[model samples]
Target: MRIQVSRQLLDRQLVDVDGRLVGKVDDVEFALDADGVPYLRTLLTGPGALGLRVGGRIGRMLVLTAERFVTDRPMVPLRIPYGLVDRVDSAVWLRIRAEQLPTSPVEEWLRRHLIGRIPGAGRAGG
Candidate 1:
C-alpha cells in the first residue's frame, strides 16, 4: 500500500495487537533491497528519536535527561520492524502484543525512579 510517510506515519501512535500503546512513530528507517529499491525498514520510537527530530536546545535537553537514566551515554530508540506492522488507521497496529516488544529504557527508568514510587502508582486511576 502506498503511504505518505510524513503524513501517515510520523508522529502516529503505535499500538500493539492487545490495544496497549507502544509509543509514537518518532522516526522511520529505510533500507535498499538487492534490486536497489528503497523500502521502509523500521519505525523508531523513544525520547532519543523524538529529541533528535525536534532538533534544538529543548531537544538536546530531552536527550540529556533520558540519557542520565542509563549507563549508556548515547541512548538508542526502540525499533519496531516494518514486518511487525499489522495495519494502519488511527494508529499503527503491530502484529504482536506490547509485552513481546522490548521496553523503552527511558520509560523503564521513569517508572522505577519516579512514577513507580508515587502512592497508588500500582493502581489504575478512576
Candidate 2:
C-alpha cells in the first residue's frame, strides 16, 4: 500500500503487536540502488534525532538531556529498517515485539526515578 511520507507516514506512533507504545517516526532513511534510485532505508527515532530534526534551543536541550542517561557522549537513534514494518495504518506496526528491541533509556530513567516511585505505579487503571 502506498503511504504519504508526510501525512500517513511520519510522526506516527509505532506500536508492537501487544499494543505497547514503542516510539514515533522521528525521521526516515533512504538509500540509492544500482540505478541511482533512492528508497526508504530506515525509520529513525530517539530524542537526539527527533530534536535535531525539530531544531532550535529546544533541540539542543533534548540532546543534552538524553546524553545524561548513558555514558555515550553522542546518542544514537533507534533505527528500524523498513523490512520490519508489518503494516501501516494510523500508526506503524512492527512485526516483532518491542521486548526484542532495546528499551529507551529515557523511558527507563523516568520510570525508575519518577514514575516507578509513585504508589500503585505498577497497575493500570481501568
Candidate 3:
C-alpha cells in the first residue's frame, strides 16, 4: 500500500491482533532494497525513538524523564518489522498478538517499580 507516512502513520496508535494498545508509531526506519530503492523496514516506538524524531529541548526532556525511572544505560526503542504489520487504517494493526512482541523496557520497569507497588495492581481490571 502507498502510505503517506507523515499524514497516516506518524503518531498513529499501534494495535495488536488481540486489540491491545501496544504503542504509538514514534518513528519509522527505512532500508535500501537490492535495487537501491528505499522501503519501510521497521516501526519504532518509545520515548527514545520519539525523542530523536522530535529533537530539541522538549525531546531531550522526554528522554531524560523516562530515563530517570530506569537504569543509567540509554533506552532502546521497540522495533516492529514492517512485515509484521497486517494493515494500516485508523490504527496500525499488527498480525501478531501484543504478547508475541518483545516487551518494552520502559514499560517493564514502570510496572515493576511504580505500578506494581499500587494496591490491586496484580488483579485484572484493578
Q: Can you give the TM-score per candidate against the true fold?
A: 0.91, 0.88, 0.91
Index of the highest-lDDT prediction: 1
Candidate lDDT values, in order:
0.93, 0.89, 0.92
- Angstrom error at residue 24, model 3: 0.5
TM-score winner among the candidates? 1
lDDT of 2 by residue, 30-97 (tens): 89989999888899889978989989999989889898987766889999998899999998999989
Query: Residue 74 in candidate 1 has what lDDT?
Result: 89
Q: What local lDDT score does residue 51 receive in model 2, on the 0 to 100 scale?
A: 88
What is the TM-score of candidate 3?
0.91
* lDDT by residue for model 3 (6-116), tens: 999899999999899999999999999999999999999999999999999999999998888667559888899999999999999999999998877778888998999
Candidate 3: where is the Cα deviation over 4 Å? none
lDDT of 1 by residue, 8-117 (tens): 99999999999999999999999999999999999999988999999999999999988988888788899999999999998999999998988888778899999999
Worst 10 residues of 2 by lDDT: 1-10
Candidate structures ordered by TM-score, highest first: 1, 3, 2
> In model 1, which residue pairs have backbone atoms overlapping below 3 Å?
none
**TM value for model 2:** 0.88
